[model samples]
Target: MTGQGSEGTFCLVLHSHLPWLAHHGAWPVGEEWLYQAWAHSYLPVVDLLRRFADEGREDVLTLGVTPVLAAQLDDPYCLRGLHDWLGNWQLRAHGAARGLPDLAAREHRASRWALEEFETRWRHGFSPLLRSLVDSRVVELLGGPAAHPFQPLLDERLRAFALRTGLDDTQRRIGTRPEGIWAPECAYAPGMEAGYAAAGVRRFVVDGPSLRGQTWAGRTVGDSDVVCFGRDLEVSYRVWSPKVGYPGDPAYRDFHTYDHPSGLKPSRVTGVHVDPRDKKPYDPDLAAAAVRRHAEDFVDVVVARLRSLRERHGRALVVAAYDTELYGHWWHEGPAWLEAVLRALPEAGVRVTTLRGAVEAGHVAGPVEIPPSSWGAGKDWHTWHGPQVSDIVHGNAEVQRELLELDLSGPVRDPVADQAVREALLSLSSDWAFMVTKDSAADYARYRAKVHADRFAELAALCRTGRGSTGRGHERAAELRRVDGPFGHLDARSL
Candidate 1:
């Protein structure tokens, strides 16, 4: 893991995703998850990147913002809800002041500061902030299927449609298509490489097992030139292991702790048995101190590993990847930790690069056929679209197939065809796969599947009725406008 020359280039991949939760669920559960994360993680992280760039730092970050999540973030309902939630957060801080113990005074003060920060920088929205970062070239925006559907579990007939549709959606948001992808959950299966190649995806991240017997560095999938970079699991898993990681730290915010009395989360994760009320509010000053310690430790590990790698492989680039949500959403102090780490990396002599930059810098190894693999347990797709998730998935996939066959392949062109296509793609997102795997809000997963499918079904119905569209297909534009998200105007004509 350590090599002087190889350590010079390190690539980090951040997968940012959340199932469609907007206008869907209650606080501390669904949409609240989105707003809380927006206030804590996404907004802060994007702001951090923007600040980094504003300071003339060309630090390259490979960020994957799944279209499904993006759609929700950019949705009118979510924007409005987020602003309201920010206001409520302020009220909660103010309300807490009356009952605060002297020992808890600092906690109340920190919450007030957190609220103020949210109001000033994030009250408006994060779409503009994210766009600015991408526009500034401070981070490489990666894309995947509109809803990040695990492709392998999907019926073969629907595979191409999902890939191409997602590609178009990515292009819509970022003003260009992404050649690189953060395959939803790093889930992959044999023969899926063809879909990626057809969609113009030149590179994607995978787990070490996907390399089969190959090394953890980058390699090609099948005979296609598309590069597959395997994650350096040893380093990557240290930040967010389900059993133990930074999130488990005593000083970090507890993800599972809920104040039974107030319905608000106040405690930091102390241990598995700690009571919610017994826990303490997050203190940023303490958390920031921890970040400094962790940053130094992480850098030390990277440097030593690089030195060791130099002894073995002469030069070997280490690629560490993790879910982007871990920063602020799960680990309350994640944003601070991230900032400290990035700022210290250069001083430690480690050059951070985007996934694409690594490919271009010749850090990638020679071509090799990758085996079917994912970052899931045992590098399998079980975490998403496995048996637990497949029963519901197969049913929805059938609807997808019928919809694509009827709506996409027709020669009777319609303006709403692209919107129809986008809806179809979002319906098949890999997010449902995750829900089924985790069993978190299975009903919501079913509803999301139904929502997209229902939209597609509507298009299918209109097409079958022979209700001819207006000039240039503008007559049915209202219907099209309704379906114009998760990637507006898919241009399915290419399919």
Candidate 2:
């Protein structure tokens, strides 16, 4: 163990991810999901990071970009779609100008900024922007399974393949392989750290409950060299509590209430219990004041939490992890709050850094055994494995069983065989199960899972019968390639 420093560390881990949404439906939960996040969350957040970088901030946070989301961000089709979406945003704002001029002006300002940023920096792809951040040490990047599969439920061989392929894909895209990962759903099972170790992962994140409330420092899982950092729920929940949090403050913009004509949020939260129709028009000045207030409050919370933890644990670390989309996507003023919080933390005397930086700064507390867990409800695996999603669970197993059977017979050789593997991997995405269980677009989730599973079955049948090379299979494979390809680095023969 290394010497503990006086200042406790704080890690801000922002998980940036969305399931593959390319060529999916447009509204409610498809391409629209991707575009809204890109415009409101991703754009503003990255802009904040670039600003911080320009000011010479290093290791400001850790960013986890799942391979599937990374692929979509860099896809040509997605790029074109985002551009069109931004253009439409501007058009909608223009149309709203007469009736709701004040709201329309705000919409215009926001949409115009989005359009300008997209044209100047993002027209080509996401890799360059994210790669720049990684190269410059603005943030530590994390790689997860290619499709963000729930690693604990996956077959050992398939999980390993997905992980390695994911790491390699990130390396190929951004020129630096990640040593840390935001485990899918922050899910874990006994001995899973070894799988991470085998893939050269040095660290991973899980919910604090998995650490049994011992979250003041990183703990090595059962003496493995790899470390597990649990999110400090005390600190994290201060900003994200489902019951009450900073984002729900009356002064912030209401995420749920929208000026439908302009596709813009036009009202302050006003009150959590206030009707959306009765909410007050958003006041930028008031929201800006709230951002400052919350930033200072959060700094106090972090300092107090760290001090209290260090009193017991000695030179502890406080990790506050949140979904990256919560910023600007779910909360209209979130990016600003994030910026204010990040800038204020250090000034309040906390040692703010990335997860990797925390490790290097000797923020570890020796080894411990983590239990089977996830960040979901009950801090267990139920979110992805609940009775509600039992069909999905069973369905995934059937597909994996079929995949293993194919592999056992012989090395699969056709490109269509690889597509079968690809579709199977897609079918196993944790998003579908999570969505279904959460009742957020359950029908779409089921439809997506079934489509991928069906396609996998058809392709696998062709491969098993040795009909995959040249013919209808090839044409079908081409369609798959054009329609849903994300991981160019994956090959079934290799997996």
Q: Choose the strongest candidate by lDDT.
A: 2
Error of 2 at 219 (Å): 0.6
lDDT of 1 by residue, 27-79 (tens): 54678878777777777787788788898766368898887787777777677
> Which candidate has the highest TM-score of all?
2
Q: Which stretches of candidate 2 lie over 4 Å from their true place?
A: 1-6, 408-413
lDDT of each: 0.70, 0.90
Relative to the unseen true structure, what is the C-alpha lDDT of residue 338 in candidate 1, on a scale of 0 to 100?
Answer: 82
The TM-scores, one per candidate, come to 0.87, 0.97
- List the RMSD of every prediction in angstroms: 3.8, 2.4
lDDT of 2 by residue, 417-494 (tens): 878888999999999999999899999999999999999999988887878776999999879978789887677877
* TM-score for candidate 1, residues paired by index: 0.87
Error of 2 at 310 (Å): 1.3
